[model samples]
Target: MSSSDIFIGETIGTAILILLGGGVCAAVTLKASKARGAGWLAIALGWGFAVMTAVYISAPLSGAHLNPAVTVGLAIKDGDWSNVPVYFAGEFLGAMIGAALVWVAYYGQFRAHLTDEDVVGDLSARAADTKAVEAREKGAGPVLGVFSTGPEIRNPAQNLATEIVGTFVLIIAVLTQGLNDAGNGLGVLGGLITALVVVSIGLSLGGPTGYAINPARDLGPRIVHALLPLPNKGGSDWTYAWVPVVGPLIGGALAAGVYNLAFA
Candidate 1:
């Protein structure tokens, strides 16, 4: 694929991926939404479907490597780094755009959920009763799971390790799977299979850091969460931001190393 194709395809694919993926979070988390409280299974399936949709749409043009970890793993496997930057540019840009669209689509729900009397009251009383607001913000606005992932327990060591292991599994699967024949994209059925892998990861490994596995998937939307004008939106938690970014890169590189040593 040419640089332009890679950019365009990744941009569009990642946008769709985040749109559907984030939309699921919004749907399940927002109070006013019909699907609110749908639980984690919905999220896992939603993200799986998101990957499938994005991959199918962008595979022809850019191999649909919506996750930066996937791109880096492939580059390491192939020993070509020229297109990595292009893929990164597209994935991040697309993630931001997709997050913005999710906001637009769920504007009413966001406003209702964030501005609810119980929630606003907690925000006002946070200095005195932090736990009171924690209930409201568990999955609601300000610190939404839709846009990005967070750890159940705030252990940096464990969080980083969780992301690395999760991403290694992902990249390793991509490298070994038959869908990766082209070296640039997955085969016709690869999208569906990869989506299943994502769901499995979420079900099995997602509890601890929400299974970011993809740097662009986490960081880009986190950036939007920080910049977007959402009422009562809490801190973007910038301190933990580097964990997802760095962990995924390390996992991708490690996966590539393993692939080179064992399979290549």
Candidate 2:
């Protein structure tokens, strides 16, 4: 195929990825009056499904990288430096575009709920659990917003720990496949590892701040959250935001570290 096709495929794949990936997040988080506090398990599974599906569809085309972190990781590991720029550009553009689309798709959900600046859904939803569910059934009604972090714990130390650990698991799995023989089943097998990693993180680690293991995953959607309409939304909680970013970066570095140590 032509270089143009590869670039375009990468862009389209990443866009749909964030939409379905980040989109599920907004669906569960936003007070859509349909399903509230659906829990981080739902979000993580949605993410896992999104990753595999994008891989299935785009793997043969542009490799369905979906995240810049992954592209850089691959480039670092495999030495396919020529394609890195193309994939990175595609992934970045797609994330921005996906953020915009997500805001649009969940527009109704954002608009229907009360916007209390002090409303932190995690605490308020539990207190209003009964009301949250009642509103969901009504459709376009009020639903309790159970605010939680991805990687789930609230404490910065704990949050960073989860991010670092979650991402470490993810990068290691991918590199395991990279280390295998060229024609091995690692291509498909890698997806299963990723699925398990995400599921495990959600079921176990997701109780706190919700594991925003992927930077663009959190940042992209958070950007949309800022743009969208919602009542009484709390601060983006920027103070603890760096954990996910840094933890994942550390995790990626750790993986690179491990990979490098092996050769050394």
Candidate 3:
């Protein structure tokens, strides 16, 4: 495919990916949504389905490398860096657009969720099982998890390691199983296989840092989180932001190295 096709395809595919993926997070996190309190299995499966859908839509145009980690892994494997910037541009832009669309889709829920002073500020008033409410600046922010990942435990080294390992598995799967005959994009069944792989990683490794195996997936939505004007929305947690991006890139590079040595 041409560069224009690659850019447009990635932008649209990634937008669709984040729209549904983040939409699930919003559905589970927002107060007025019916899916609120749906557990992690819902999230993992939702994201896997999102990947499947997006890849099927964009695989012909840009190989549907919606995640930067996947794109980087492919680039490294092929020893080609010329189109990396274009891929990054489309992926990040699509992620932000998708996050914004999620906000639009759940605007009422967000207003209700964020404006609840008792929910935002009063831990005593919250339900015993309320996992979505988090206090910051003495009030709650829109749940960051809907837009980006955060660690269950705030250990930086461990958090980084978790992202690295999760992304390594993801990149390895893309390299080994999710390639077309031309080896540029996913095969006809690659999307489904990759989606299942994503589900597996999320089920097994998502606990630590929410399995942010993609840099653009985390950073773009983080940028959206910082920019959006939601009342009582807490800080964007920028201190931990680099872990998702850096760890996945490192993991992608590592996966590519392993593929070259063992599989290529």
Candidate 4:
């Protein structure tokens, strides 16, 4: 693929990936939506489908490396760093666009959910409670989960470890089983198989930190969440942001090392 092809492919692919993946979260979490309370299974399956759809759509152009971690892993595996920055730029830009689109698509539900006294809890009362204020600043608020991942229990080490482990599993599978014969992108059936692997990872390892497993997937939307003008949207949890980005990069690099040692 040419530079333009790689950039365009990744941008469009990551946008669709986040649009559908985050759309599922918005559907299940927001009030006044028919799919509200559809539960985690819905989210996992939705993301799997998102991956499959984006892969097929972008594979021919840019090999559909929609996640920064996947880009890094492939770079390390192939010992080619020439295109990493372009991939990263496209992934992040696409993620932000996708997240903004989700906000637009679910604007009413977001307003309804965020403004509900039952959900956000009397803002004055929450303000009076210092702990609540602190928690909201340092952790995720009610609707941040729609755009980003956060740990149920706030332990940085544990959270980072979970992301690393989940991403390790994902990258290893992509390297070993998801790539096409040319080693550029997913094969005809690889997208489906990789999507299933994502679902399995979500079902099994997603309990903690929501299995980010992809740096661009988490950070880009988190940035959008911070920048957007959503009502009563709380802090972006800047304190925990590094865990998802750093953990997935580490995991991808580790998977590359293992693949080079055992599978090369």
The clash count for each model shown is: 1, 20, 2, 0
The clash tally of candidate 3 reads 2
Each prediction's whole-model lDDT (CA) = 0.88, 0.61, 0.89, 0.91
lDDT of 2 by residue, 1-264 (tens): 345666776677767767776677667766654656777677779877877776666656675566655655666666566776777667656665776686677767666545533333454564468665444333222321222133333567877877777777777666666332442112666666766776777677656656666666666555544544555443454555567667776776677577667842
lDDT by residue (tens digit), candidate 3, 49-154:
9999999999889989998888889998998888888899999999999999999999999889987875576645553434534436322245788999988898
Return the candidate ranking by TM-score, descending.
4, 3, 1, 2
Q: Cα deviation of 79 in candidate 1 (Å)?
A: 0.3
Model 4 lDDT tens row, 1-264: 799999999989999999999999999999999999999999999999999999999898889989888888899999999999999988999898989999999999999999999999899998999988888766677899999999999999999999999999989899998688779778878899989999999999998889889888999999999998887788898889999999999999999999999999
Q: Comparing 2 and 4 by lDDT, which wins?
A: 4
Whichever of 1 and 4 has more TM-score, that candidate is: 4
Model 4 RMSD in angstroms: 1.4
RMSD of each: 2.9, 7.4, 4.2, 1.4
94: Cα error in model 3, Å: 0.3
Can you tell me which runs of candidate 4 are displaced by over 4 Å?
A: 127-135
Candidate number of the best TM-score: 4
